[model samples]
Target: MSVHFKKKAANAQTAIPTASLPDIIFMLLIFFMVTTVLRETTVQVRTILPQAEAIEKIEQKRLVTYVYIGPKKLQNNQVGETAIQIDDALVDEVTNVRTIMYNKLTEQPRLIVSLRVDESSEMGKVIDVQQELREAGTLRINYSSKRDIEGTL
Candidate 1:
């Protein structure tokens, strides 16, 4: 008896199509470009920030209120030294600051108010501001400062 032997079929090759990969990447890039929100930097008066040894990292959700101190020039054309300006205006009293802060706190109770005072600013003024914030019911206050080498608070 003669038996016919069939040749083993060649190994089947499976090809994966990668032509859609570029298209998928392009679509994702376009989606991110269209949906991404660009954050604008906050504006404030320039001041030399104080340095600290230990500092805490601020969360993104915290609300920041900037208070600037600079000089107030006289209307008679006399230039004065730098002074504090709260919201672009001179801080006449803690009440004014408290009023504004109170309004802001009312809108956002979990506000983490950050104080970025200049190194030369009077401690009394800074403490007053903090006191005002405390009176206004803003308990979460952060003092922003540059980190020193020793990492002391």
Candidate 2:
């Protein structure tokens, strides 16, 4: 005995429904919107980071806090002087750095302070920041720098 398939429908629907696509796209948009971390604070300070022979990429972005130290970017470089910036605020006194960093450390115990120091900035300022960090007990620090290329084509 032989079996045969029947195909005798003339008005049957054959096209796939397109109604769910917009909902799917909307869901994806919402998913990405929630997952992405928007940059809340803009880096207002001008820091020309020094060069280094070796460098490593940070694995965790959330575990890092940036401390900007440089000659304040102003209309005239001569008028404005070197300053320390934490988060979005400028620290008028160096002593405030320790308190701020200590608070941050309490919030995030594994936080690594990344110091972005300018190449032309005075070394004394950096030493001061380091001393503050040491007092704050934020010893796990990383110096942000560019890769040195002396004799490269």
RMSD list, candidates in order: 6.9, 4.3
Error of 1 at 145 (Å): 0.4
User: What lDDT does the true structure give each of the candidates?
Assistant: 0.70, 0.88
TM-score against native, each model: 0.60, 0.74
Candidate 1 lDDT over 1-153, as tens digits, reads 234576667888778789999999999999999777565443234456888866888755446666664344565655455555655556666677788888988898777887766676668777777788888888887777887866554
Give the C-alpha miss distance for residue 20 in model 1, angstroms: 7.0
Off by over 4 Å in 2: 1-35, 76-79, 148-153
Tell me how many clashing residue pairs each candidate has. 13, 0
Q: State in Å the error of residue 52, model 1.
A: 1.0
Q: Can you give the lDDT of residue 34 in candidate 2?
A: 75
Cα lDDT for residue 32, model 2? 100
